[model samples]
Target: MAVKKPTLFAAPLANNGSKWSIGTETNVMKGLSQFHDPLINWSVESYSIDSLGESIALVVRNPSEDMAVTPRVDIYLVSADNSVKPKLLTGSFNAISDSPVFIKDGKKSVAREWDCSPESIVWSANGQTIFAVATDQGNNIIFAINATTGNCTRMTDAGSAMGLGTLGENQLLFQYTEQNKCVDIHILDIETKEMRRLTDVNSDKLRNVYIGQAEYFWFKGALGDQVHGWIIKPLQFNTEKKYPLALVVHGGPQASIQNIFTSTMWNSNIFANTGFVTVQINFHGSTGYGKNFTDSIKHQWGRYPYEDLMIELDHVLDNCSYVDKARMGWSRWVRVTAALVCHAGIFSTPGAWYGTNELWLPEHDFGGTPYDPKARSNHEEFNPERFANEFATPTLFIHGGSDYRVGVEQSLAPFTLLRRKNIPTKFVYFPDEDHHISSDVDQIKWLTEVLLWISEHTNTTLPYNLNQ
Candidate 1:
């Protein structure tokens, strides 16, 4: 098997009627001959053999680092007997990345990343169709690929559909979630293209809760590309009245704030319920857009994403009459504090010094290590400390002492700077917690502190009594 890159080969399939056996070194066994194009630089992600062992189904991917080149993922079919070369069975599309769908208090939400690698692939009993679950737009939906024609059909609509399993020949069992709904077991009939719910366990608990309505919109962002975002209106919303804006910027930089439900601390509904119009932007570096858009943030993180957020924020303020631009406030992850400082003079983690346990992340984003002369300029250009002189917005610093990924000192530095400058700022420290506030008590305190800080800055009264 003469191939440039390391190749993965499946065990020899049982010979049904062909002369080829386990030891045969035929076209199928020869790595380059399988694709008949050695320069393709493809690797198999997953494979399945038919019951008869005559055909093998494979999921192949070609990844590249160049931002101009889009990554390719496709399904291929090849004969086990070495009788034919590999044939493409589907168009280019990401299978699924390590994107996680969170389930909390019966509600579900998704956190998407730039990597769109598939989770699992399975062939139908008859070997006529293949089923795959992938992240599309903001939802993880199911796709059915035709075995022979390379045609693809979407099986599920609206929400994060996952945990795919073969129930029978033409039926599939899976889990489903939505923006206002929780996780539920579902059954899908592939032959008839019909779906039915198997469980509604969270309906009773969520029946009386007031959940805000989410509206999605797109606008021209940096590079003239369309950027996606969401606006969640307060419950019992009045169009005639102006409301404060709670703009939430997601972490990952590579991750996206999806359209699914979340009942936990980071839920968008929390802001809406507090009489604020909540907004979220899936900026340039967010996942599910495509490889090029995701990689576009490399070496230009602070420039493009910040431009997208400000541009989209302007778009919202211009179009949404109900939003109060004067009372606008935002919260974001610790790593991307440059945006916060640049936009509002508000800053978060990693003050004057940048230190993180994840070396690969910084190296990959900045194009090289901090010590590398060619990449040092990129780091200094985006660091939040460079803009410290302009810091004026009343800021709140929160950190967990056990957070090794981004040490607590990152938050302390900025807090100290603001105090020395006599800026209105507060620090909330959790000595026992880690990167995330996991305990129920800490969760409540975290939310309270955040809401209180935002309410104070925006000069808005809390919908619920904080003293209670």
Candidate 2:
């Protein structure tokens, strides 16, 4: 079989410019425009290559402060050229070519987007047709457009793109988002368009749930009337064992925690492997849901969602026989503090120093303030302060010292209050870390420490010596 040559097209750098400029390359956004000097405003970049060695097309970015999107991209091509009197092609909204393809001198031709700023094509497969997944006006869609004619077709419907992607040949994989925060994986026949669901691996009602492998069950959003959530549980969950539970409140009050691929968990398999059930709720306020749900969470921050968490906890506890109602976040935070008080582990510190076998991976605590609003859902519902004083869970507070999202301060507030209540608690700080712990080594070590803490307090058999 003969090997085909590589298909290469002009790849434009959308945001490349001088260092001092608030340019695309720098990813700097400014509310004010003043590019008369050393590039204080104006983002810039361009494309100047062609496959034929003769320049065919050109792309450039020119930014403006008037619009939310800076530096609108402008595309052009070399219409014609001569040694002395050369030619130039320029157009916005649409570009018209002066020559034909292959038979350049035969007829006039051109291709362009119906709306210049609506979509940007960075890559394309399947001939000259460019395919992309785009979210516009609160709907997600897969669009295929002709590179030559600029005509387009929208494939895949809203909600259907939630868990969609490629797996292997003749197959496309994806998950569907359910109203009450449920996600299910499905496979579509590329040729037939016939789709089959391989697994509802994350459903609470399943027997062989793909623990930690698939997205967890979705729950009603805390931020909205009918939003959803994604929940993760332990890998080797024992129905008989009453395990510790954690509701990882992710920030991005507007961003629904999607379950596609996440390195953010920081090798969280350790959490499941260690016998703890972790819940990551998309909660209300997440995107993916329509604008109504996303915007409902705008003014109402901490309050409504915590109640949502409580309700979900009750639902899980009632359904899953193994989850101990006594074994939750508030309880965990306090229990750990009590262990320190009673000096429960004589060998805990020693075993903890033993170092971790798993590789270090960074992690983070979830949650953040929603879009600024003077009004909140009855401060009582969202006030962690009130709950913090009474929280008796064996909780370990882990946060990024530099996290601007929910801020390390959020963790500090709860930890401080819980400590005052004489609740079991430990607040560990990763000095240079941010929202999601990025350093693998730190995550592993942090997780190991958490495991040891849980083991010692829960009366499980884990290494107590830090050196173990």
Candidate 3:
């Protein structure tokens, strides 16, 4: 690495075979045999290893940072010694940084990225022929890539609308999704164009479908509704007792809250099994619901999505009698009021004022008053004021340090305002996390807090690992 200005870290690659090296755009190359120094003026934002461990470095000529810029890639070779080596190709590689694939031979190149990506290249055993499989996304034709010609031909287009898998340099398998009413084992095979159905469920059935999840429910929402939700209950379910429930709102007014495993809500399981109900809602405007529903969020982002969540809340609290709403109580409401009133605390940029509230459209205030009569123009008024004077229920607000959605202010605003109002509100900030705390330690620590909340509020024993 050259003595360049401070750099923001990106994706990483490990140097295993020592056949590759790194070169900075500053013309400073690493891993040279000391035989010859090649000076080619080019810059690379980052570099990574391919599945084959070939020496492919990504070089982006000039990238724009002023706005959302598309990512591009170029591949290079390196020698065992700590310096850039012989060139393979010097032309454009069509691989979009989204799934970049640049092919190089001697001094030329052929690049490829996908358009409606369903068909993809699966590595063949010899690394000579890759699997080319396509489906509704187009086609999947497995064959060989002339590492020399940059040309490709299909081996098994089978024409069965097959799902492609690479068993080796020349082998592949295809599968598909199935339909059941509600089962645990989720198997999706787009390459094979198959669908599975979810059938029955019970406590013991938990082990079968949910992989230890005691209870799960699927809610199909209404009202511009393409919305869906998943409720993951504790592995230990007690039919006789009620439990505290949480409504985790996935942001993205345009992004769906998936039932699959993800870092954002990885800590959800801890609370669920500890006598607390963990619920995630994918509201109306969430993506994966189709284009019409997604586009609805545009221009009118906050209002419609908020309505969906409110409906979701109603769905949870209404049908589920065992839910402990008192646990949600007043303190949480107060914090929410604070967020709306003061726009929560800021992050990443500018003053201590927090981010969300600062971006609150300036047109909100009417009559030059902090408590504006116009705030509830279209929204019904349960209470005209933002933070009711004396509220109950201790509330905790968490935010990823780099979360732009809802902004750090969204969390902070509620906490700051609620605390100032003499409400019991707690705020915890994840320093290394953005939107989702990707680190395992940070996730466990977060799980601990929720566990404590559950143990204190609900009549359930805490997990042993969290006892520490």
TM-scores of the models, in the given order?
0.72, 0.52, 0.52
Cα-based lDDT at residue 163, candidate 2: 36
| Candidate 2 residue-wise lDDT, 140-187, digit = tens | 455555667877666555442453455555555666543232456777
In candidate 1, list every pair of residues with a backbone clash.
96-117
lDDT of 2 at 38: 45
**lDDT by candidate, in order shown:** 0.70, 0.45, 0.45
Residues 1-468 of candidate 1: C-alpha lDDT, one tens digit per residue: 546754445456456686656654444434334344555455656666656666666655544422123334566667776577766655444332222211112222122332443455566776666677777677787778765665677887767777887898889999887766778899999978798999999888988777876788999999999998888898679999998888888777688876677667878888888988889888998887888888999988788998988887789889999988778876542221211211112232223124555555666777776677897887777887777787666778788877755667667777788899998878888889887778889889988888888888788888779868
Better of 1 and 2 by TM-score: 1
**Candidate 1: worst-modelled 10 consecutive residues by lDDT:** 336-345
Q: Which candidate is the best by lDDT?
A: 1
Error of 1 at 101 (Å): 20
User: Which runs in model 3 stand beyond 4 Å of their true positions?
Assistant: 1-62, 68-97, 101-165, 168-222, 262-267, 325-393, 399-411, 430-435, 454-467
TM-score leader: 1
Q: With candidate 2 superimposed using the best TM-score fit, by how many Å does residue 131's alpha carbon deviate from the native?
A: 4.1
Off by over 4 Å in 1: 1-116, 147-150, 333-354
